[model samples]
Target: MASHSFQTVFAVPMTCGGCAKSVSDSLYKLDGINKVEANVKDQVVSVEGTAAPSAIVEAIQATGKDAILRGSGSSDSAAVSILESFFEPDARANQETPDDGVTRDVRGLARMVQVSPTSTLIDLTVHGVAPGSYRATIRQTGDLKDGAASTGGIWSDQGAGDGSGPRGLLGSFTVGPDGRGSAYINNPFQIWEAIGRAMVVSRQDESAGPLKNDPDTVVGVIARSAGVWDNDKSVCSCTGKTLWEERKDEVERGML
Candidate 1:
């Protein structure tokens, strides 16, 4: 199905008009993009498209420049969740380590953008984990004190289902041999409906019941994300670090 178009803002370093034109041309080559605007002075690029934000970042990076997502969608249309694995200290110590000797509790990230009143786009990305199939779902509560166990049952939209089958099945995706995977999903719900809820990706299927005590299962609360033009800070006020500096830290933490 064709996804509804929304605007996404990206921070890209550009020194001149030529640089701006080059960035614009690169984005134009991508599918689902309808408009591209590159501002050299501001070092920012604005794109209107149905393409996933990851795809846009990849396209911009193809030009040998880094692309940082400043914001996406409009107003309160965007949301995000940082999926992390939860386990006991002993169990965590027993898990396999990465090749680089870095232990990452974070497994994936889910970016949600509401394009229309009834449809929302979810850009799910996972990395640094076992290569296998996993189910993605929205849970009823945001509590994570006990991990997935405290998140409650699957969340279903009012009057949408017959209440007989899997309730909040967003879908399933598979991680690859390189321990990386991504899925662009469209769900029949608005952004507001999912805020403060919990998103879980697990090795179990929908019929397996609530995910708990599973070392591989990852969960996070869905939180609001900044929209297009809503965030303009080049430096984080809390950490006092430049955006690129923070990006480097994120990279080390296995956040691709």
Candidate 2:
């Protein structure tokens, strides 16, 4: 078997020794993986083996954390490419439409459907919207898909959103003549956020106090929600509190 090794950066909220072990064990389960070494202090993981990078990433994701392949190598580079491949360009380019119809901008119409261990697919519908170039920001939180938790991380149009400075455009979506179209953005932020929100809701339902001593879940939720606020930059007034404080306040007020 051809021997290959590569390093990937993961945004892991490893608050304790147990959390680090959990992440390591999860990565070690991939096929063709010879060994998995994680640096809890630096949030980096190095995998050695002939396994495909995508497979490794999928395995890590199955553990309910976000990871991205970084560094140099065919495997690492290819992994990034595979992730980016999920994004599809405009289906109906340069199409004209009626001037008096209600138009839903691209960002407003895009719907996030399925988020798998390694991928997220969003469906965008342009029905009943006017035709024009609309910009939108796609952001996400870092948490487990099934777990009720939150984390922080956001991926938006390269240069078309709140933080885009002169290059960023506000949230918008385009409408076509047929009023139907779609776009897809692949990143780890949204997955994390979904997981974090679920965690918050779960704890809320259980009547559990705000996450204390649970650094992973706490940081995860804060990171995720912060991303949401950043997309607009108006919410929270950009305070960007830590996960612990946010949880404390929410729990005290009976809010998750």
Candidate 3:
């Protein structure tokens, strides 16, 4: 059997459990599909099998949602590619890594990272720290990859406590003098909840005013959710460009 793995980002937003289940059910109908996992929270879908990438993309698009494949590899090469992509420049630039050597990056946005079926104990390294608090999240992909029955979770730094929170998807790890540690996401639901909470947190702002049923508030929430934050400057990164500037750039690039 041909095996492949990759990650992608979904243009559409998946808010609730029902929305996730609907997409999962829709993608399970394709041929040559061995397994399908969906992380509604992370807006990712991971697949493994001999299916063509184009076919997988089509199946997802057919469900009225937008999907993009970020990377892919076949057989043994697939595993190497998946691991390397985790530390790529583009991926690293998108996340906030402390100068103190605490780096956290999101892998397989719309796909769940998977290991061999028999493998357990997802090992991870936290480079550059000496016993500090951290949290991690494990996300699974839905039907975006060709259908494959594979699921894997990565270790994250969960502040304090036994790393049990939300859906038991949250985990805590302490780095030794060598700046390395490990954790695991054993249950599927735990992985699901971790991704879900991430989706919600990525779009939420605690500093924002009280939630109301007003349309303006809804719009504000959407804008804030999509907006990026600069920890060093502590301001809205979106403010750097004007609406017309963005539109002009998009038009110039034929994106408009």
- Model 3's alpha-carbon lDDT is 0.35
CA shift at 208, candidate 1, in angstroms? 3.7
Q: What lDDT score is found at residue 128 in candidate 3?
A: 30
Model 3 over residues 94-133: C-alpha lDDT tens digits?
4544144433231211222333342212223333333454
Model 3 residue runs over 4 Å out of place are 1-12, 74-256
Question: Clash number for model 1?
Answer: 0
Candidate 1, run of 10 with poorest lDDT: 95-104
Model 3 lDDT at residue 23: 62
Query: Which residue window of length 10 is worst by lDDT in model 2?
Result: 79-88
For all candidates, what are the clash counts? 0, 33, 22
lDDT of 1 at 32: 94
Which tens-of-lDDT digit does each residue in 43-105 have in candidate 1? 999999888998888888888889889899998999999888766666444555423433447
10 residues in a row with least lDDT, candidate 3: 216-225
Tens digits of per-residue lDDT for model 2 on 104-190?
121122223123333333322233233544333222433432222222223332422234332111133444665333333332232
After superposing candidate 1 on the true structure, give the runs of residues whose Cα lies further than 4 Å from its correct spot. 88-104, 159-167, 213-215
TM-score per model over all chains: 0.88, 0.31, 0.29
Q: List the candidate numbers ranked by TM-score, top first.
A: 1, 2, 3
